[model samples]
Each structure stands twice: as structure tokens, then as C-alpha cells.
Target: MSAVESSARRLPLVLRNPSFGRVWAGQLLTQAASRMFQVGAVWWLVGFAGGSHRGLDSGLFLMVSTLPAVGLAPVVARVVARHAHRTVLAGAAAAAGAVAAAAALLARAEALPMAAIYAVGLALAACQALFDPCLTTSVPELVEDADIESATGFELSTQSVAGLGGGLLGPLAVDAGGLPGVVAACAVAYLLAALLVRSARFPHATARTGGGSPSDTAPASRTLRQVLAGLPFIRRVLVCFAAANVFTTAVYVVMPLYTRGVLHSTGSTVASLEAALGVGTLVGSFTGARVPGRPVAVGSVCLIVMAAALGLPGLAAGHAVALGALCVVGWCVGVIGVRFVALFQRLVPADDKPQFFAVMQALLGATFPVASLVFGALGDHLSARTLCLVQGVGLVPVALALRWAGGRTDAEELPGSATQSPARAREAS
Candidate 1:
């Protein structure tokens, strides 16, 4: 058997299955490459900025990079539903590769102004914003409803593996080539990913029995008013999602500061810790996929555990002890990440999936800037340990919120709508 098939055979039944295996492999490589680019980009910025007087912090740069994606996600979502999912994805991947290549060239010439970087970053985000829903929507086509949970879990596991590889490898590219090398590495990865994902053969979209074409059978196209009407469900999901983002954002911003200032760890140690989190996430993805009933509850527990784990360093005897605790925290974070997306898929309407997912992404995107400001202030006032402790404490309300949301929904809410054509076409009926 080929290596991919042999690897599949060694996995669980769901993962070993033919169709799901391809989807899983595609996601695994894509996520790994994406993270590699992220690290590479950050390294590139460090080189480009090149001075004690450099204006933008990495957190702020990331915030700017993501904000455009959030704002434009609705537009991206509409594009995904209007065309073949893979077609849209392939195009986006190609666009991403082109942007990465351009960024690399610019970095080499030292012509990579902050504005230019932000513009490229915006283009990259636009590509990624549609990626989640497109892939999630494709799952129903690839596997039966009974197999979806397993498929979701496997996808999450793949992401964790990718995240780990990207995390470890990204910094190395930066070390070797500085900003230019990092950009080249990211461009190459994106090109490879685009090629791999583009080549995969997925089932064609078709209407159900007795229905017309899937597009024609889709719910009437929503008007601006109708689209806005989806706000309630969107709101419910966004609130909890926003809360979770806040918690994670705090960690993302503070983790580096903690290692550098408090733990006195090296960059290598920090990268390893990140990879550890990916490993934890991979483990959590499988467990989450297999867990029955109340995906939100599982997520809640993960949030609580992640929150508690952050405080483990308080009991640590030294830096090494603290690093060990951070590793455990990373595992919890990974599990929560998988559940975060799964719960959204469970809750949104099929037709509204793109818009709703966009809203969530917008909220998530918004939170980073907010966290930067909030934690930046907190850092000024408190010790890094105290800041971590406060973040842990803040998660209590979020954990409670998840528990509350989990109990409110019916089993068949079905995240997507029945129709998803041109909003005007949908409205004609």
C-alpha cells in the first residue's frame, strides 16, 4: 500500500475511510503551511522594522492583519456559496501564494512598508476567511451525517499536527533567512498547499431527491433585511465566541511576555511550548471527535481546564516548573480550539453558514486588538504572573456562558438554511 493509505489504515475506522482520509490530509497540510507563514511573516516584520524605535508591536500588526478579513468575511462567504467550494478555495490558495511571493520579494528589497505588509496581510486574510466554511460545508458531501463528528475530529487532529510542524519550522526559517527567508518559506508552503488541495477529488454538489439542482433548491436568496434577521442566532454564538476569543487572545498576547520576562525562557523554549500546545490540541481533537452529545459542554470543560492550567505556574517552584504547567495549558487550549469551530457548525444554518461564520471571525478578529490594548495596560500595572492569573479568572464567566448556551438549543436546529441561492432569487418565493 502507498504510505498515505498505510498511514490511514493505522488510524481509527473513521479516519481510515477513503473519503475522510483525503479531506483530513488536505487540512493537515494546509494548516501546517498556514502557521509556517504566520511565523515567517512575524520574523519578516522584525527584520523590516529593525530598530528600537520601530512603531508597531507584533500584536498590533496581527490585529491589523486580521481586521480586514473580519470586515470582508461576508463578501468572501457569499463567493463560496455562489461557486463550487473547491474552485473558490483553489483560487484563494493561488491568490495566497501570489501574495506570499510578492511579500517575499518586497521584504528582500526592503520595500516592505507597514502599509504594504498590511495590504498583503488583508489579502491573505480574505483568502482564509472563506476557508473555514468552505471546508466545513464540504464535509457533508464527503461523509454521512453519522460520520461527520468523526470527520470533524480528524480535521481538528490534522490541524494540531500542522500547527506543531508550522510552529517548530517557522522560526527556523526566520533564523536562517531573516524576513526574506521566512517569506520564501511561507510562499513555497502556500504553493504546495494550493496544489495539493486543488488536486483532491471531492463529490459533486447535487440536489436531494425530488429537489431541483442544489443551488435551485437552496432557500430563497436573503435580502439585506433577511440577512440581518439572522442576527439573533449570530448574536448568541458570537457572544460566547467573543468571550472565548478574549480568553485566548489574552493568552496569545501574554504568553510570550511571560516566557521572556518571568520564566526567563529562550525563544526555542517558547516555540517548543507552542508546539506542545499543538500536540495537546491534536490529542484533544481526537477525544472531542469521539465524545457524544453536547459538543458545547465538552468545550466548556476545555475552557475551564485551560483557565485553571494557566494558574499552575503560581504553584511552580521555578521557571522549569512553570514551563511544564504551560505545556498542560496548551493541551487544553488545543481541545477548546477544535470544539470552538465544531460547536459553530452544529449551531448555524447551512444557508447562513458563511455569514454567521464571518460574524464569528469578525468578533474573533476584533478581540485581538482589544486584548492588546487591555493586556498591554495590564502588563504595565501588574506582574506577568498576576496578568495570567487575571486572565484565568476572567474565563470563569465564559465557561459559565458556554454551559448556559449548551442547554438552550434543540437537537435539530441545523446550522445552515434550506436555501442559499442569490438572496434576490431566494426572496422571490
Candidate 2:
């Protein structure tokens, strides 16, 4: 093959589109900065609490940050429906940068109270709640239909890459110049993301809501009705994803206990397990688009594999086995997550995409914090191994249920199917 052919084969088709490439680059920076901000803020909060009620403070901070996804999603959906994709993306990024900069300035002056930090976190989280769904909905508009899956795969990979980047960079920044350095770094990232997105083109011709469309002027009630009408097709998959998150969250609660109680290990072992999981997720993200099948079916299989991986650590007698199991869990999650995102992109109408993704963010976001709390409470009464086994067993039924519920033909899942009226489609768009 010629060098050009080899290069074409090696590169992701979506990235060849300059507009998408810029937007993707912005996503990378924004996500990494978000991670860094999370790390720096949490670490600072813990230390500032002086080890008294440290866990409670940290937990509350995380919950506060997450609440926006659930509470503000409806409002965000409306905002998204009324604005251009590029406008929303750029504005959110700018808002995040401004918030980070304010936090950094306050921290430098030693005037950063816990309450103030919480407020900053809430602001940043709200920005993210707006930014993420808009970005997800923009993918199809940015790339050709044929490249959507590959684009989704690349987008999903951003989290793993950001996780690894933040894990490494967060500590270095903290060590070099403490919380101020990290927050400053985050501000720079957010601003850069804003600039990149501001310059990128989002074609208005294919847009569903903005550009003075009738749907842009539609009442919130009608929008809600449209979203509700489409729920039955996707609810099963959403439930399955949420249920799987229970097991995933349990890892955070159970891993430390499992390490100390079962493996008789230390913090280094925990770090190793985390690193393994991150590496596996990175690998899985790159490969997810290549796996051939209907996305929903493939995601179901991935959920099953993930459930088994979660349970494996409980049955393992050595650290290596547990490590391998977590790696598998991460890989399955990465694959299934990409598939689900791509599936939603295909299934949802363009106008309803924002609301759909917001609902998704809320569903997935709620699972982690709530499940972690429940698992933490349970850990007080149960062995880590037993809890792991129970979580694994619990997800089997959810996974199977998703497979059963996903039996509808692809035609039925689209917007203008027999079950939907032409008038309703027109109103929705």
C-alpha cells in the first residue's frame, strides 16, 4: 500500500475533518482541566478540614458538584435547544475558566473558605452539565454519518486520557505550587478550550433547534412531552447503565478494604489497581468502534463482562488476579460507554438530543455518589468480597433485562417510526 493509504487507514476518519479535530482538541483540554480541578480542590478541602470530618466534607463536596446534573439538566436542555452548538460550547468553557480563575485568586489570598470553595465547585459543575450534553449532541453535526461511531469512540477515549493526565499532572502541580498552581492550570485549559471551540464551524443547515427554527420557540412543556414520548425505547438501556454503575462505584468503596483485608496490602497496591484499570480503559476506547455489532447488543455483552470482572476480585486469592479483574472491568466499561453514546446519537432526534443526553448525565451521575454511599454503609457490615459478589450478581439481571428489552428493530427506534406521528416529529424539530 502507498504511504497515503497507510496513513489514511491509521488515522481516525473523524479527526480528518478540521472542524471536528479542533473541537475534539478542545474537549481533551477541557476534560483534563476538569479532572485537575477536581483533584486539586478535593485535596485542598481535605487538608483545610485538618483531618476532622474530612471524609464527610469531601463526600458533601462531591455530591454538591454532582447535583447540578440532576437538578439543572432540564433548564440546560432548554438553553441548548435555543442556542447554537458553538455558542453554547464556547460560553460554557469561558464560564468554567472564569470560575477557576476566581477560585485560584481566592486561594492565593488565603480567603478561600470551605463555603466559597463549594460555591465555586457548584458553578464549575453547572458549566460542565451544560457543556457535556451540548458537545455530545454536536458530534453528528460535526462529522459525517459514517464517521459518527469513530468520533464517538474518540470522544469516549477523552475521559481515560484525561484521567491519566490529571492523575499525573494534578499531583505534580500541587507539589510544585499547591492548589493555586493547579487551579491556574485549569483556568488556562478552560480558556484555551473556549478559544478553540469559538473558532470551529458548526453547520447551521443541519441543526435541529437553533437558527430561529420553530422548535426553538416551542414551549418547554412540549419539549418535555417529546422527550417523555421517546423514553420507552431508551429507558431499559439507561436503567442497565445505571445498574452497572452500582458495581463500578462499589469498587471505590470496596477496593481499599479488599486490599487491606484480603490481600493484606498497602496504598501502593491500590494505586497499581487504579493504573491497571485506567490503562485497560484507554485500550478499550481505541478499539470500541472496531467491534462489529448493533451497539445496544454489544453494550449488553460488555455489561456482562463487566459484571464478571467486578465479581472476580472477590474470588481471587492474589493481587495479580484482582488487578487483572479491575482491568477487565475498566475495558468493558470503556467499550459499553462508547457504544451507548453512539447508539443515543443515532436513536435520538436532533432537537431532542440535548434533553436526552442531559437525562443520561443525570442518571449516570446520580448512581456513582448514591451507590458509593450505600456501598460504604454496607461495607461496615459485610466483607469486601461478599459485597463485590453481591454487586456483580445484582447487575446480571439488569444486563439480561437490557438485552431482552433491546429487541426492537432499528427502524422502530428512530424518530419517524410508525409509533410516532409526522405532526409530532415536526413539532419536535
Candidate 3:
């Protein structure tokens, strides 16, 4: 067996690598602070609205923040391809810190306008869009290939852990010192992330050159065409990923509505459900790495489970049932996230990683605002339970498509597959 296959069943040991450890630590701080920032900003926006249409205002604020991802994907991809991974990482973090610091100053001065808040949110979101792909592409350069899956699992877990921290601490920060305090805390966290990233040494030269020698790096138009032509598997997987995100986004929108309309509960119940999800995802991130199987196959199963989890609350109206279902959904999400990302890392060529990942991030980022708007509008006419059922049913076909695409791609990557030579297939696999 190959080293990666043999080590597949072992626990993730990537943290033992000092470089990866530093990057992971930075991720934890940055993401946690990001969540805290989101919570505080939303709260402030709600108060700023000071009307019955506060929800509309907050929603608009979030939608506008995500606009950078959709509108600037090509620009971000070019920037990532041209810059060193560490440069992108540190620069993005530092830029975000500067924006947050400026916001804190404005808030403290009691001169923060809605337009300024919106601009700050947009700038921070753009930084995140750039930082995420750079970080993902840097992992293969930091550790042994065998540890990539484990590293990805740990990375996915950071988001869950961060979400929990932000959810729990953000309100407390606001209560104690208000929006300025939370913004200042975010600035500190982001600067610390930049410091950690700047300190870590990436052993591979490719990390410095952004994955290729200057001669190998093509122009943006050629690189885009090359990714589309050479990576059919990534293309197919991205389709599945986009489809699954529709339901994922639906769940986010539906949960609050379900709590209010179906369970006759308050926002506290929504918080409990979110807590349950975070816990489940935390467990699943670790567990997924040790469960021995091909990543795509395992991820297909997780998608199936997630489909069921989305539908369960519709069938059972109890709050306990809803929480349990959401927990299952979260678990599945954790597993699928690690598995698919690992698959992408393995399949995508080094020269193409940035652009492909940039596209993936942009696709995911765009899905949230569009899907949220669609489902939020639907909530006005349809019952929350019905919307949940529709989302669940919608995902069934997506799960099947993922399985079919994965199996087909794996077959194509095997020796003697109809589409590729044995040597090329070996390299692809």
C-alpha cells in the first residue's frame, strides 16, 4: 500500500509539524474573531435600523458584504496566483485588521455611519475570500502528502470551534464594552493571525512562488481555460458542491423560521440548535479522518445522511427532534467538507490550485446570499416545515449526482480506465 493509504486510518498527525501547527493556530484565531465580528456587526445593524424592517436591513447588509466574492472572483484569483502564499495570508490578515481597527475607531467616536459599516464589512469579506484559498493551497506544501486529509479535517474543525466561540463570546463582548470593544478584539485577533503566519516557515519553494516557476505560470485567461479543460473531475465535483450548498443555505434560513413558526419557540431555541450543530461538526471532523475509506465514497454517504437530517424536522415538530436533526446535519457537513477538500487537493494540479479553489470559494460565497434571498422570500408564502421538506427533497438528487460523479471520476483515474493512459491515470489518482 502507498503511505497515504496505510496512514489513512490513523489519527491526523499534521499538528506535530510546526509549520502546519502555526497556520492552523492562525486559522483558529482569525475565524473565531471573524465570527465575533459578524455577530457584533449584525447586532449593531439591527439597532441602527431601529424599525420593524430591521431584518430586511440586516439581510441587505450581509448580502452586500458577500458581493465581493461574486464580483471579484477573477481579480482575487489573479492576485492569489501572482503572490506568494505567505504573502497573501499575512497581507489579507493585516488588511482585515486595519479595516477592523478603523471601524473600532469610528464606533468609539460615535461617528460610524451605515455606509462606513457596509464598507468595512465588504473589505473584511474580501480579505477572507483571498485568505481562505491561499491557506488551502498552502497545506500541501507544509506537510507530507499522507497527512493532507488529516490537515483538512483539522482545518474544517477550526470553523466549527470558531463559530461556537464567536456565538458564545460575541454577545458578552458587546454587553460589556459594546461594538467598539468587539471590533477592537477582532483587530487584535487578525493582527495576531498575521504575526503567526509571518513567523511560520514553509519548506517548499513552490509556496514562495505560488505553486510554479515564473515560466510555468500562464496568463489569467489561459489559466482559466486550462483549469476548465484539464480538470473534469473538479468541474463535476464543483457542480455537486454548488447544488448541496443550496440546501445548506436553506437550513440556515429555515432554522430561525422553524423555531418561531413551528416550535413556537424563541431565539434561544435557535441558539441551542446551533450549539448542537457545532458540537456534532466538531466530533465529525476528527472522526472522519480515522474512518478508513476513499474520501469521495465516504463523502457521498455523508451527503445522504445530511439529506435525511434536513427532512427530519419537517416530519417531527418537536424542538428536541429539530436539534437532533441539525446535529446530524452538522456532522455530515463536517465529514463532507474534509473529504471533498482532500479530494480536491489530491486531484488539482499545483499550478491550478489557486484558481480552482478561488472559483470554489466564490461559488460557495455566492450561493449563500442568492439562496438566502430566495428562501427568505419563500418563507413569506410557505410554511417553514414545507420549505424544509422542499430543501431536503431537493438535496436527494444532488447527493446521487455526487455519488455518480465521484464513482465515474475514480474509475477514470484508475489504471486502464477508458479515458486515460495507465501512467497518467496513476498520476491523476
Candidate 4:
């Protein structure tokens, strides 16, 4: 096990690609900032609203942070695809930094209204609409095709590490620096993410484009239409992408209920569950380098494993059992998410990556509020264990459907996709 684990820690190979290293480092900072932001934001909102309708306030705030960004994704994706990833990403980060700074100032003054805070959250989310896709799509740009998976793994690992740190340190940050300090810290993080990635090149930005000519008056509508043109392909091959996001979001919605009501555990125990999952995910991100299969297929298989693992929490008789099951779930999340995203990077046209990711993100965001409300409301009447069971069982067919669709579409699109060729295919139908 030790020898196998040592082999999995191939951090040097990825870092050797300086461009990728900078992007990876920047990604880590931004991801950590996101966690910090969430912690600080949730705490502040909870404090401000007090007891009554606290659930509504918290859920609405969380949903607001994500939903508004969806409408802006198509535009964000278009910009990212048309311009250099570095430019769009840096700009977005700078914008977010500015917003965070303003929010920090408001927080320091204790003048931040819920509306203002929600607006700032919306602004940050909008910036992410641009920054997120560029960051992911830029990975393939920075690394060689053979190392794409590693690069993708490195990216997901950033989230795991951030999650661990954010959930752990967020409260401490709030107590030490207060909400203002946390927001300020996030500002600094965004700025750092921008500065780091600014020097990185985006080779894929040079792909075929309708713009960039000196004489041509590039029409915005035309560019948008071209960007939206990839929807058909995305729909056919990525049926489960949105479903996966919904399930993952549902887990977040359900996790707390399970901890408090079902396990009769304290808040710290909820934190522990998140920490366990983060650790498990971190391990998976590195070791999954040897997962040994096509990313789409491997990802599909991992989803099934994750779904199975999710079902375990429902049956778990105690905290330890549930904790172990969550770790398994996290491992699957780490492996499968990277695989699916790497496949997205590989299969989509270099120019259309921004569009593809944006649309998907938008769709996922659209569901965040709906899923949160549905789960939150249902949790009132149904047992958390029952909810977990339903969510777990529900995902199995989605995984299978994704796998079957991928196989058929990939085989049709790529010549030798009989093995894992489906992922390599540029377009299906």
C-alpha cells in the first residue's frame, strides 16, 4: 500500500509544466477563497437574520449566490472562448477581488444589509461564471494531452484541500478577523489567483474563430450563436453531468440534517464529516492517476460506486459507519469528477470549451436553488436516512444512462472508441 501510494504522488510531473503549475497554484488559492467566502457569508447571514426564518435566509442566500450566475454563463463562456483564458480569467478574478474588498469594507462598518451582501455574492458568482470555465478549459491548454488527466486531478485536488481548510479555518477566521477580515482575505486570495495565472499562456485561445480580424466588425449575436452551437453535442453525450451536480448538491443539503437529527451529533461532527470527505477526496485525486481506463468510462464506473456509497449512509447505524461511507463517497467524487471534466476538455473543440462548460454550469446552478428547497422542505417530514436512500438509488440509473450514452456516442464519433474512443470523439450526432 505504501509503495502504491508513493507511486501515486507524481506531483513533480505536473509541476514541471510551469504554465500548468501556475494555473494549479492559482486554482488552489481561488478554491480556498471560495470556501472561506462560504463560511464567512453563511456565518454572517445567520447572525444577521437571528432565529426566525433562519433556514429561509440561509438557503436563499446560498441559492442566490449561485443562481444569478447561470443567466450570465452563456455570455461569460462566449467571452472566454473568444479571448485568451488568461485575460478573461485574470479580469474576472480582479473584478471579484474588487467586490470582495468592497464587501469587506461594508462588513467592517457593520453596514452590510442582507440585500447588499446578497448582491456582492451575486457579483462574485458572476465573476466565477467566467473564471471557472477558463480555469478548467485552460488546463488542457497548459498541459500535454497525455498529462491532461493529471492536470485535471490536480485541479480537483485543489477543491478538496480548500474544502478541508475552509470548513476548518472559516470559523477561526471569523472569530479572529471577523467577517470583514474573512472577506478581505478572500479579496487577497482572488488577487493572488489572478497574479499567478496572468503569466500563464492559453494556447487553445488561438483555435478557429469568427473574430480577431482587424477589418471584420464582429457581431455579438453571431458569436453567441456560434458558441451555443455546441449544445446538441453536449446534450447527447453529457446527460448525467447536470444530474450529477444535482445529486452532489443534494448531498450537501442532506448532510447536515443527517448529522444533527439522524446521528444526533453536534456541529463539530458535521465538520468532521466534511473533513473526512475532503481527506478521502484528496487521496483519490492523487491515486486515481492509476485508475486505468478511459476517463468517461472510468468516471461512469466511479459514479456507480459513489451512488452505492451514498446508499451506505442511510443504513449506517452510527457516526463511524456514516463517516466511513462519506469517505468512500468523497473518493468517488474526486475520481469521477476529474475524469468527466478531463473528458470535457478532450472532447470539446478547444474554442468551444468555454461555451460547453458555461452552459453546463448554468444548468447546474439553475438546479441549486430548486434542489436545496426541495430537499430542505422534504427533510422536514421525511427522515434524512430516507432522503439519502432515495438520492442514492436515484443516481444509479443516471450513471448507467450516462455510460451507455457515452459509449454509443463516442463509438459513433471516434473511429476506435470501442475501448475508450468515445471520449476522443469531437462530436456525436
The numbered model that scores best in TM-score is 3
For candidate 2, report its TM-score.
Answer: 0.68
Backbone clash numbers for all candidates listed = 17, 0, 0, 2
Residue 301 Cα positional deviation in candidate 2, in Å, after optimal superposition: 6.8
Per-residue lDDT over 113-169 for candidate 2, one digit per residue giving the tens place of the 0 to 100 score:
778877987888889888887888788878767678988978876778877676456
Each model's TM-score, in the order given? 0.70, 0.68, 0.71, 0.68
RMSD of each: 8.2, 7.0, 6.4, 7.2
What lDDT does candidate 2 reach at residue 42? 52
lDDT of 4 by residue, 189-265 (tens): 98988898897776655563334673366333324246545444446545576677667667665666676567775
Under the 3 Å rule for N, CA and C atoms, how many clashes does model 3 have? 0
Question: What are the runs in model 4 whose C-alpha is more than 4 Å off?
Answer: 1-24, 43-55, 78-91, 111-113, 134-160, 171-181, 191-237, 259-268, 286-304, 338-366, 379-386, 396-429
Measured with C-alpha atoms, the lDDT of residue 84 in candidate 3 is: 80
Ranking by lDDT: 3, 2, 4, 1
Candidate 3, residue 388: lDDT:
80
What is candidate 1's TM-score against the reference? 0.70
- Residue pairs in candidate 4 whose N, alpha carbon or C atoms collide under 3 angstroms: 410-422, 417-421
**Index of the highest-lDDT prediction:** 3
RMSD of 2: 7.0
lDDT comparing candidate 4 with the true structure:
0.69
Candidate 2: stretches off by over 4 Å: 1-19, 39-54, 137-156, 175-177, 201-237, 250-275, 285-308, 311-322, 338-361, 375-429
Residue 263 CA displacement from its true place in model 3, Å? 6.1
